[model samples]
Every structure is written in C-alpha cells, then in structure tokens.
Target: MRKAAALGVAALALAAQCAAAAVPVQGYAIKATYPHDPQAFTQGLFFKDGFLWESTGQYGASSVRKVELATGKVLQKRALPEKVFGEGIAPHGDSIVGITWMNQAGFVMDQGSLSIKGTFNYMGEGWGLTSDGERLYMSDGTPEIRVLDPKSFGEQRRIKVTVDGQPLAKINELEWVEGQIYANVWQSDRIARIDPFSGRVLGWIDLSGLAATAKAGKDIDNVLNGIAYDAKTRRLFVTGKRWPKLFEIELRPAKK
Candidate 1:
C-alpha cells in the first residue's frame, strides 16, 4: 500500500511539472500612439528606414502604402490590380514583396518607387509575411509557417506552431521581432510570440480592450491584426483593420 502511495505521488509531481511547462498568456501596455489612416484595412505592416509600410486588403481597395510614422501621411502608394486581394508585405533586398489572397501570386516592387517589378506564383493562400533579412517567413491562415527563399520564392522549410502541445491556428499578420515571430491570431485579440526554429509558442500578448478604445463611431472590421517592429528604435506597433489609431505597446507578463 505504501509503495502504491509513493508511486501516485511521483505521478502527480510529474504531471505538475508538465503543466508548468505550458506557456503563459501576457498583456500589453500602450507606450505611445500614432494616427493611422482610418480607411486602411491593414493586413500587413512593417517598418524600415524610418517609414511604416502597410498593406491593405479588399479586392478593389488592396494597396501598399509607405506612410510617415507620425503624421499618418502616405508618402507613397501603389494599388494592386483590382482582381487581386492584397495580404502581406515584406522587405526583400532593395525591393518589397506583397502577396495576394486566394490569387496565389505575389508582387515584387522596387522599394524606392513602389512600382511592380514582377509577380511570382505560389501554391497556397498567403495570409502574412515577414523577412529575417535572409529568408521570408509566411503564414497561410493555418498553424504552419513556411520559410521561403527570398530570391526564388521557393519554400525551403515549414514550422507548425503550437501552444502547450496544442496546434495554434488562424495565424495572421506576422512580424519578426527580436528573434521571435509575432503573429496575430485572426478574429482574436491575442498575438502569439513563437520561437522561429522550434515553433513553440513562448507567450501571448492580449490586447483585448484595444479596439474598444478606438475613436467612437468609426467603422471597423473589429479584428485585431497587423504587427510591426522597428529594429532601429526597438519599438513595437500594432493596429487593427480599419482602426484609426496605431499603438506602440510594451508587453507585460500575465499573472498566474
């Protein structure tokens, strides 16, 4: 009887340790605010060389815009062909690449001119994109992230994201921040911070009340999306679809 009791205690201790290994959910504190185009249905966002590059979706209104970080002024803009719905944008070498939803095509543009350089074809839907300077990380609205060669636009590898051993789906707009891949979960106020190599979710950033704080009466799609990190300034920014305000947020560890 004593041996059985000892074995049961060991089992309980092992279970407790396994439970402790689960990742924690976190929240954010707004450090600053910036004016964003209220009409912009942001699907992807990134910062480079002091400018904010944004991609907006919707069949006819899909566009890529380089905006002034502070004033929300569009410095340059290029509209995608009306038939394609824009999804994600990433800096590739001296150029930029933007992907389309459902079209399986991606556009390469000259960074300075924002003019289409060419289009490349891919297999699945493109939901989010980001570059780690060497390779492109892409999400297809599933739990998997594909690593592609920036030059050939060919898939090199894939990572299946999971939180505490459970698959995480609906991964949306992505930004590679401080060596971690940050992705917005579609239709949710949570953002998953994932390990690039292991695909294990390290933590979650919950911005639950953010959209409610938007300008009253402004029309919005009400989904939390879009993440951009300024490596030069080490600033993190987030905005939602059709949200008028952009926020720079600081992460806070959630309580146990």
Candidate 2:
C-alpha cells in the first residue's frame, strides 16, 4: 500500500512538471493611442513608409486603405468588389497583396497607388497575411500557416502552430515580428508569439482591457485582431475589429 502511494505521488509530481512547461501568456502595457477609423472592421494592419496600411472587411464594405496614423484619414483607398470580403493585406516587393475571405481570391496592387495590378487564387479561406521581405506567410483560419512563394503565390511549405505540443487553431491576423510570428487567435484577446520554423508558441500577449475602454454604447464587433510592428521604431501596435483607437503596446512577462 505504501509503495502504491509513493508511485502515485511521483506520477503527480511528473504531471505538475509537464503542466509547468506550458508556455505562459504575457500581458501588455499600453504605450500610446492613435486615431483609427471606427467604421473600419480591421482585418489586417501593417506600417510601411510612414503610413498605416489597413484592410477592412464586410462584403459590401471591404476596402484596402492607407491611413494617416495620427489623423485616421484615408490617404489612399481601393474598394474590393461588392461580393468579395477582404481579409488580410501584406506588402510584397514593390506591390501589395490583399486576400478575400471565402472567395479564395487575392489581389495584387501597386503599393504607391493602391491600384489593382493583378489577381491570384488559392484553395482555402483567407484569414491573415504578412511577409518577411522575401516570402509571404498566410493563415487560412486554421492552425496552419502557409509559406508562399512571393513570385508565384504558391504554397512552399506549412507550419502547424502548437502551444505546449497541442495544436492551436483559429490563428487569425499575422505579423512577422523580430523573426517570430505574432498571431491573433480569433475571438480571443490574446496574441501568440510563435516560432516560424518550429511552430512552437513561445508566449502569448494578453490585451484584455483594451476593448473595454472603447466609447460606451458604441455597438461594434470588438474582437481583438489587428497587429502591426514598425521595425525601425521598435514599436508594436494592436487594435480590434471596429475599434475606435489603435494602441501601441509593450509586452511584459506574465506573472505566474
């Protein structure tokens, strides 16, 4: 009886160690707030050449716009066809690429003019897109992140995101930050920092209090979504679908 009890305790200890090995979720400290278009249902956000490029969804309302970060003014805009629901936007070589949800179609546009230059098709639902200067990374509303050939827009490889060896699905918006892939899990206020090569989730950023600060009585789809980073300024920004403000945040190690 004593031997069995000892073995049980040992097993419990082992299990505790395994649980402790799970990656931790970090929290963010808001650094600054910037004006954002409250009507825009932001699906993808990025900073480029002193402008904030955004993709807004909703079939009849979808658009790709370059906005002034301070004034929230649409500097340049391009509307998607009424039937297409825009999902994500990414900057490629000298052009920009925008994807549509469920339509399985994407558009390539001139970065300078935001004019449609060409179109490309893929097989699944488009969710998020980002690039690391050479290759394109995309999410299809699944745990898988597809690496695409920038030239042909063909899938070159895939990385299945996992946290503590368990697959994490609904990986939404994506931003390649400092060699790690930062992703928004749909409907969650947490962002996962993942290893691009290993698909291991290194940590998570919790932005729980952000949406609550929105203007009272403003009815909006407030799920935490957009993520953008400025490598030169080392700034990180996050916002939500129809959120009135964009926040610059700094991540801090979460307390155990």
Q: Return the TM-score for each candidate structure.
A: 0.90, 0.92
Please write out the lDDT profile of model 2 over residues 62-180, one tens digit for every residue. Answer: 99999998888998899889999999899987799888999999999999888899999999899999999989999998889999988899999999898877889999999989999
Q: After superposition on all CA atoms, how large is the RMSD of candidate 1? A: 3.9
Clashes of each: 0, 0
lDDT of 1 by residue, 1-256 (tens): 9999999999999987776556677877999899988888899999999999999999899999999999989999999889989999999888998898899999899999998999899998999999999999999999999999999999999999988677899999999998999999998888999999999999878888999876623454657889999998899999999888899999887746
Clashing pairs in 1: none
Global lDDT of each model? 0.90, 0.89
lDDT of 1 at 53: 96
